[model samples]
Structure formats: structure tokens, C-alpha cells
Target: MTHTRFPKAVLFDLDGTLVDSAPDFIAVINRMRAERGRDALPLAELRPVVSKGARAMLGAGFPDVAASEREAWVQEFLDLYEAELGLHGTPFDGVEAMLAALEANGTTWGIVTNKPEYLARKLLPLLGWETRCAILVGGDTLPVRKPDPLPLLHAAQAIGVVADDCIYVGDDERDIIAARAAGMPSVVALWGYRLHEDDPFAWQGDVLIHAPAELCETRAWPGTGTQA
Candidate 1:
């Protein structure tokens, strides 16, 4: 995974890696629980599952619900989340500056997340990333999603960059798995949501960065002589 030059493109995971959407999830789920006369869970209790997506969050919020019932509640949760998408969420610290740095260096950057396309697109405009992002590949954009190389490969193709010429940054193991399968180098964003049981080292990302600011330094990137 050595590289003679910096990556031509940088692809990011949305929820946890680029945007700190945990606040939004916390607000929505708590509000939903309140409406059902259920006690609100602590924000800390739910934050870790944010990267795991809606189902996990719902399960945490409604622990007694049946699996089939929880599945039904997912759409309800998504509906609530969409109505207030960017109201409570903001990009992770320094994400905008990192993207700007990449742009100034002539490196195209985009998003490849497990979020649905509609919601992903909706959130971008709210964050003023509509024009800044070179491409976006949502979970449902293809038949497969993260942990599968197709979405990552498709994003590279859409941006006219070879898979090997891209670097994928995400907070989850699935993100690393997908990048590895795509033959692209990857960085694990340690600042993102994760449970106590989660282990970034076990994920084996090419680099582990504690914040988006680290991305501005080429030496901190994978294939740049940084430790994996």
C-alpha cells in the first residue's frame, strides 16, 4: 500500500467521520422516546451507536421491542431524522478546513457513506457542501453498501480516480474493510462514534487519526510513511 504520491482523491464516511450527527440522533431518539412516555436515554449511551446506524440506535432506545417491531421503528426514526437533519448536527471539528486544504492542493474529495442518498444529499446543502463535494455514494445507491467494495469503487469511478489513487476515511471497521477490498488505502477516524468494545487497531486501518485536523498533514496520511 505504498504510494509514490499523495492520493488523487479523498472519500469520507458521513455520519461519524465527517459530520458529528450524534447530537441529531440523540435529540431525535430522545424526543421519540418522550412521545411514547419512555425515559430518555443519556446522550453518552447512544453516541457510540451512531456510526452503527438507525437500527442500532433504535435498539438502544427501545430495548424491549421485538426485532420485527424495531425494524418497523427504523422508518419512523428516519422520518423524524430527515425532518430535522442538520438542525442539531455539525461537521466534526476541522473537517471543513481539511476539505479546503485538499481542494487547494488540487485533490478532489467526496463522501461515501452508508446513509441513504436522499438524506445524504439533503444534509450536504444544509452544511453548504453541495458544490464542494466532488461526489457522494450513499448506502442504497448500489445494491451493496459498506464492507462491500462496490460503493467505494463506484465513487472512485464517478470522480474519475482509480481506486488505488483514493484514500477512504471512516470510523467503522466496515469502512476499512471496504477500502481494503477496493485496494485503496484508509485511515480510521478515532474521534468518531464507537462503543467501548470497539477497537480501531483491530480494524487495521493504514493510519489512525484523532481528529480531522490531522488530515491536513500529508505525513499523517496512510502511504505517506505513517504507521498503519
Candidate 2:
């Protein structure tokens, strides 16, 4: 049961894991609020739910909007976010070094996110990931998304890696759920968004990392150099 120091590949969750896109989300939400004369929400208040997607974000930004009307609100949020995408977001600290190390070692990597395919694709060049990212599977790329495992499995195959040989890094509980179901090892990104209610330990990830920098040192990886 030995493992390679570096997995065959690493699959990341875009919003919270690889990139700190919360600022972009906040900009969009705040702009929407300002249009209605509402004050801006502190970044801290909205950061925790960024990975939960548009509806959750709109829920916080427009509390007065009825649940039934959320469908329309969500679209508006997305439209604004799409326009704001790549304008404010940047890779999380240490992510560049980690990805550099992976590429230096010839370990392939990709993104699997719940963001719409068009948006994710549109975000690639802006984030300088258009050619760097080996593969991408958006929320709508497949019939189902994370918490379903299909996206993770498909991403692995697309990059020529088997599920068990890949590592999935994400900020949400559903990320671990999908990785586990797909037979890939999961790393819980502690630096990613998590409300006070989130208990990453309870998620039972294979590894829990405090920052993207932790992955920069190849020897520091769990099971690194352990493979026979």
C-alpha cells in the first residue's frame, strides 16, 4: 500500500482551493446591493459561502428577496460575476509555487468546479490557466457535479490518470465526498472558505492543509517517496 511522493495528478476546486475568487464574488454582490441602496457586506461575512454558489451568495446579499424569486436573483448575480470574473480574483497564496512544482515534476493537474462551463472556460486565460490547466470540468460540463463523483472521475480520465492515482484538493465538504466516491485521495484545503459551522475534521479528508504553500515542498507530501 505504498504511495508516490507526488500523486499522478492533482485536481483542484477553482473558487476556494486554487484561486481566491471571493473578492470577485464580493464585488458582484456589493454592486448588486448598491444598486438597491443597500450597504456592502464585509468580505468576511460573504467569504464563507462563496463556494456554495450563486443562490447562497444571493441569499446573503439580498435577504429581502423571496426564496421563490431566487432563481432570477441567482442569474443576475452570475451575470454580474461573469463580467467581474478574472478582474479581481487571483491564485491563492503559494498556489503558483505548488503548481510550478507539480509541473516541474511532470505531474499533471486540472480543475473540477461547479461554476458554469462557459464561465470557467472564460476564466482560464484571464487566470493564466488556459494552457497550464491540463483539463477542466465545469458544473454543467457533465450532467451532474461534485457530491456525485462523476466529475472527479471524468476529470481523472480526461487527464490520463486513474482515480486512485489522483489527489483532489478542495475547500468544501462535497469535494471530499466526491473524491472519496471516485476513489481518489482528498486534501481538505483549510485555507478555503468555511463558515463557523464547518468542521473540516468531520469531513474525514485524507489530508488537511492550512495553505496552498504546504504543497510546494514535494518531500512534504503525505506518502511522498513511499511508493515501491
**What's the C-alpha lDDT at position 222 in model 1?**
74
Candidate 2 weakest lDDT stretch, 10 residues: 219-228
* lDDT over C-alpha atoms for residue 158 of model 2: 92
Where model 2 places Cα greater than 4 Å from the true spot, the runs are 1-4, 223-228
lDDT (CA) per prediction: 0.88, 0.87
lDDT of 2 by residue, 87-140 (tens): 988999999999988888788899999999999999999978899999999999
Candidate 1 has its poorest 10 consecutive residues by lDDT at: 219-228
Give the runs in model 1 whose Cα sits over 4 Å from its true position.
1-6, 224-228
Model 1 lDDT, full chain set? 0.88
Q: Tell me the TM-score of model 2.
A: 0.94
